[model samples]
Target chain A: MARKTTQTRKAVVTIAAWLIGIVIFFPILWTILMSFKSEGDAIKAPLAMLSSPWTLESYGEVQARSNYALHFWNSVVLSLGSTLLALLIAIPAAWAMAFVPGKRTKDLLMWMLSTKMMPAVGVLVPMYLMFRDLGLLDSRIGLVGVLTLINLPIVIWMLYTYFKEIPGEILEASRMDGASLRSEILYVLTPMAVPGIASTMLLNIILAWNEAFWTLQLTTSKAAPLTQFIASYSSPEGLFYAKLSAASTMAIAPILILGWFSQKQLVRGLTFGAVK
Target chain B: MATEHSRTAARLMVSPAVILLFLWMIVPLGMTIYFSFLRYNLLNPGMETFAGFDNYYYFLTNAAFWDALINTVTLVVGVLVITVFGGIALALLLDQPFWGQGIVRVLVIAPFFVMPTVSALVWKNMFMNPVNGVFAHIAKSLGLQPFDFLSQAPLASIILIVAWSWLPFATLILLTALQSLDREQQEAAEMDGASVLARFWYLTVPHLTRSITVVVLIQTIFLLSVFAEILVTTNGGPGTASTNIPYLVYAQSLLNFDVGGGSAGGIVAVILANIVAFFLMRMIGKNLDA
Candidate 1:
């Protein structure tokens, strides 16, 4: 009886998981389907929509009209550029906070995270005016600066958590072997923490890449990322459902691929400190 | 002596990030506080004057302020409840051995990576449209009238979208936590004649307390400032049905150009968030110290 009950329970779980997973993923699948349809057929009955012949007209039109190359380039540059800059700054900070026992280290970390909690709109106006005055509006450099600052806390926090997990004895041994501080960090500590660093970089890139609030507010034509690219399709010239879906598919396709490939690392990085 | 010198070096290495973040926080916050005390509007250009608490008074007393405040609280609490409960159920399901487990996990987490704006647009067009949406089609097939999700139930719709986006986060955390549970404890419970529900309540829920706390705190921080979802779906309303504090601040400043009043509202939002953060920090502090 117990074995039978357990088998039944397992079957129930299997069916429920599949159902929920498909439902959760339906929108992305639907959008991809719509991207391949003609505009008229894209909005038809669901059965008819699927039955319609697939076409690449929407992709071709999106590429021609919207400067897809520029938006794609901006996205790559902004996401990667901000992640690298943030790491360059965050690693040393996290290293210190992790290794060096200071009375204020935990306080400093909490303060940084608290600043992150403060509503971003509180500072949006001032940041806007500052960027305007500095001629950084609609500039990639300005966005890199903003993204780096905004994401610094997460990078530092994640790295700090990772750094703590790695026993200090390893670094202490490196120092005993006559390694200078630079070589100690560059050679020994960094190599040992490569997985952590890699995951942090990957996660930060995803966050900065998908971040829409600041990206939309701070950028327009000159430096807009794919989020802005998707936004433009919202008010199209006509009922261009297919074209809009194509733009969205193009915009999300790269990140989705990256996410799929690195999902394990992404999941690990997110839940690293939380689960423990 | 060398240790002391390295400590100094460590401080130097960390200072650049510290200083940059300090500037990032203080300059804008200082400006906001200063602006809240003055009569300022970009439109008027040069007629700035000291208004003291007038801007604060106007913002504090506005009906939109309360509406946005209530909406903000509702969205945060609503999304938290759905994600936490749904996440627990999904995590439990995924914890059991199953075929295609990897595929199911990937599909479950896919929505989290979709850009929030694209998700909102897809929901608005394909699922929630009054005339031709899937929900409408289903209702028609079943001989029931479909209600406008984004119109009649704007706040509820926004909450649903936000909850969907965050459910994976909760699930992932709980799933990880579940994986690390002591198998011995479960086996021991079974040997003692405990039923499934009893074992879950007695053994599993207590083990998941830390993860549950982390999910709630982190999701609350992001959800309280939810803007993009509301912006793309309902534009904060058919009225102010879905305007949260962030949207309210945007309408006040950019739409109305009331910089002074907007800053005042911004200050209030910061204070309100700090209250929430206070409890969260205490929780984190206790959890970490444990």
Candidate 2:
């Protein structure tokens, strides 16, 4: 009797969990499904829409009408560009903080994290004016610069936590073996740090990709990423649901896959190592 | 580890990041404070003059500011409440042995990866629209009136959308924390004949408190400045009904070209965020010691 009850309970829980999961995920799933339908079919009621013959007309329309490739390339460049730049600046700093103990190292790390707290809106006016004055407005270089600064603290923090996990003894052992400082760092630490650096890069790219505020405010035509591209559809055009879905599905698909891979790092990075 | 040579190199390596961050934080912030004191307008340039605290005075006294303030708090608190509570329930459910758990977890977390613009547009167009929306279709099928969500309840609708995006985040963190919970203690409690609710209240809740606090504080920092969703969806209203502080400042300066007034609003937003940041920083700092 007891065994039967436990199996039945598990079955019930499984069904309930799957039901809730499907409901929660329905929006994204529906969007993906709708992306394949014709404009006329997409506007129909849910079941009818699903039953309609799937087509790639919307995807082709989105690209042909909007130059979707340009925006897609822009997103790729901005996210990758910013993440790489931030990594270049953050690696040595994170390395130093992780290995080198100082009287105020903790305070310094905390202070850097606090800078991340400074709301972006608080600096919007000055940034806009400065960007305007410097002729950097709506430029990829300018967007990259802003994205780097906004995300630098997170990059450094994530790198710091990851680098901290690397054993210091390896470096010490390398030094004791008469390896030069350069070789010790290049050979001994670099290999171990690569995984952490890669994960940090992944998380930062995801952040920069989805960064909406600065991208929207700064970019108009030239440097607009996918976020801006999708926002253009906000004003209702007649029966463009399929096209919008196609664009959105394209925009989110890459990052969703990337995000799933980086889920563990995300918790630690976002929390600033608080929860993990 | 603290050798003098290494210490010097560390400082050298660290200074570039520190100097850049200092300039990044200070320069724009300084300009904002300066601009707040002047009657600056982009449209009518060269007529700028110091206006004392008149800008601040007007911004504070404005009816729109209060509405934005209230909406900001409502959006933040509303999303936090939904995400945290819903996250806990989802986490607890997922923690149990279930079929295809990994795939289910991925599905639940998919929303967090959707860019804010995409999510907002998807929710607005595909799900929440009065006509041709899934909700409208369902309502019609049930012989009920199709409710226009964004206009009828602009702020609340935005909150729901924002919460949907963030629910995955809260659930992910809470699940991570929950998985770390000592199974031995749970088993021991079960052996002691503690009811499921009793064990949850005593053991599970206490373990989750820190993660929950982290979720709340971090979410508050992000939620306090929700912009993209509002921008894409309601544009801050049917009539300023959904505007939050960030959107308010954006409108003040960017839209109206009222730099002085907008800077004042920006400063108020900074002050508000700082209050939350103070608590958040203290919490994380405590964790650093631990």
Candidate 3:
């Protein structure tokens, strides 16, 4: 009888959790749903809105109205480009700090993290002026450089955390086996930290992809990513409800899919030290 | 043995990124400091002189500074409270064995992956619009009045969107922490005839305290810099209702083009952000070391 009651209680909690989770997720789901509806049907009452016959008209219209492919490409280049650059730079820095102990290692890491805390807007003027003066504005290379720098600390921190989990004895063994420093890290440490690195890559991509401030302010036309694509739907005249939702849905779809596939790694990377 | 040559190589490998960031930090900061002491504006080009703390004095005594300070604090605190509490509740619920658990977890985390601008736009248009939004439809169906979420309570609405976006982050962290708790302790507590509330308060909450702190610290860092949401939704209006320090600085520089005043405001923002960062860095540093 007690076991049965416990089972029932568990069932109730599970049901409630599912209900709340679905409710929380409804907005995103609803936007995707609305993206399939015609403009008139999108603003219809909720009851009819959900049950309305879906169409691809909004997607077609959104494509016709905006350069979806360009935005998609810019997002791809900026996010992947910045993430790759950051990892290349961060791996070495993290390797030094993680494997090679020095007095200022912790202080260096702290300083990098502190740099992240400085509000980006605080330096917007200088960055904008610098970019303009240097003719780097609205360029993919410029955004890549800035994005990589901003996310460098996070990338290093994550890689450093993953590197710490590795036993020093393993590296000691590799070194004793005549592995050079380059091969030691490239062959041994890199392979071992794949999961951590993969998750960090995924997380950094999401961050850079979703990054709105620099991307919005720095780029006007040439290199504006999907964040700009979504923002374009907003105007002083009025909000474009249906088209905006469509843009938002399009902007987030790829990352949402990516996040779903990498949930395990993300969860683990996030909980790296919380349990300990 | 790790040789001196290897250490030098390591430093060389990291030098490009380090030097870039160093310049990135110094150049802007030096400029802001310089501009803070000078009389400069975009409109009054080439007519400049060192004003010696005049900009600082003006900014400090201004009411906009205090308003932005309050809004920034309130937004951060409000979002933290909601996410932390809401996250704990959801995390506990998710910890229970459930059918389609993976699917539910994905759904819970989906909002976090949405771009802030997109999420804000989603909330602004489809969810919170007074006439045609889903919330209005529901209110009307239930025989209630429609509400203008953005206009009536702009700051609160923005806070809700932010809290919603961050809920999954907190929940995932807390859930991971919760799962790490020893099952034996919970069983023992239950076998001792402790009520559910006592078991939760004593066992689960204690286990989650560290995760809570981590979540609070990380989220505080991100939340303190919240800009995209406010920019997308209300543009920091209904008369500065949703304006945070970042928006305030943006307005001062980009809109007003009062370079000296704006740079001084920028320094003020830096000081404000560091106050939180100092403590957060300490905790994060401790966590990293451990």
True contacts kept of each: 0.63, 0.83, 0.68
Predicted model with the maximum lDDT: 2
Which 10 successive residues of model 2 chain B have the least lDDT summed? B281-290
Which segments of candidate 1 are over 4 A away from where they belong?
A1-9, A174-183, A236-239, A261-272
lDDT tens digits by residue: candidate 3, B87-147: 9989988998877788899999999899988888888888898999889998999999999
Candidate 2 whole-model C-alpha lDDT, 0 to 1: 0.94
lDDT of candidate 1? Answer: 0.85
lDDT, residue B72, model 1: 94
Docking level of model 2: high
lDDT of model 1 at position A11: 83
Q: Please rank every candidate by DockQ, starting with the best.
A: 2, 3, 1
Complex DockQ per candidate: 0.63, 0.83, 0.65
Chain B structural similarity (TM-score) per candidate: 0.96, 0.99, 0.95
Per-residue alpha-carbon lDDT of model 3 for A1-276, expressed as tens digits?
Answer: 999998898889878988998999998988888888878888899878878897877777777877777888999999999999999888878777887767777888788777888888778777877888899999999999999988887788788888788999998898799999689878998789898788889988988999989998898777999998787665645466667777778889899999988766665454434343
User: lDDT of each model, Cα atoms only?
Assistant: 0.85, 0.94, 0.85
Error (Å) of candidate 3 at residue B90 is: 0.7
lDDT of 1 by residue, A118-164 (tens): 88888877777788889998899999998999989888888888888
